[model samples]
Target: GAGVSQSPSNKVTEKGKDVELRCDPISGHTALYWYRQSLGQGLEFLIYFQGNSAPDKSGLPSDRFSAERTGGSVSTLTIQRTQQEDSAVYLCASSFLTASGNEQFFGPGTRLTVL
Candidate 1:
């Protein structure tokens, strides 16, 4: 079966440009997540979606960052106004469910560079 997939493996944009990253989760998985990894930094949880429940946007850095899962399968992360601080590798993951301890398969991620 196909695992998580992301588009535009690498992206370079000027400091105020908007960028949209896409993710396609594994078939039938009910859980989806977005994470960001910056240079010389660790992975940071961004947002998550599970089934029909409301998404958890607690981890979103700011209001400029947002995500949505369509048909419970594919997801997209949009950055309203890109900044140098927003430059990082945005990773997406999915799982069967979101329990206390569930396995999450990750996507390769899209590296966004802000110039």
Candidate 2:
């Protein structure tokens, strides 16, 4: 009955480095999603994975962004060659179903800062 959790809660790194963020989805939720929200910006979808379906990565900002979900539960978002432009709050959400507008519960998020 635990909720989703993200690690570090804050990260700062030099530009052109790589960073990995972790997400722990709620148990029994079949759908998981990743999103990015910069300061004063709206949440933008990055990637999604549902039960036995192809992952959706269309919302990823660029080739530097990628993610994967394993065991239908936990997911990790890895950023290659981090840039200052990539600094943002990386949020993770999960839901019972894959329907659009589903009420997804979000984690506190890992705040990434690329300097």
Candidate 3:
């Protein structure tokens, strides 16, 4: 089976421009997550989606950031009015949620550069 994958492994855009990053999770996985890793920083949780329930977006940095999952499979993270501070490696992970806990499989990440 294929693991999580993100598109445009590298993205370069001018400040104030918008960018869309895509992620495809493993089949039949019920939980998906988005994270960002800035230079010399730990992974930062951006959002989480599980089944048909509303997504947990508390981790989103600001109104400029948003995401959506379609058919419970593919997800897109949209960053509007990109900023230099928004430059980072955006990672996607998926997992099968179980009572005993689960491990998240991560993607290579989409490196975003804002200039």
Worst 10 residues of 1 by lDDT: 50-59
How displaced is residue 77 in candidate 1, in Å?
0.2
Clashing pairs in 1: none
- TM-score, per-candidate, Cα-based: 0.94, 0.92, 0.93
Give Cα-based local distance difference scores for all models.
0.90, 0.88, 0.90
User: Given candidate 1, what's the lDDT at residue 79?
Assistant: 96
Provide the RMSD of all predictions against the true structure, rounded to 1 decimal: 1.2, 1.5, 1.5
* Top of the candidates by TM-score: 1
> 1-115, model 1: which lDDT tens digit per residue?
8999999899999998899999999999899999999866789999899964546789999988888877888888999889999999999999999885999999999999999
Off by over 4 Å in 2: 52-54
TM-score of 3: 0.93
Q: Model 3, clash count?
A: 0
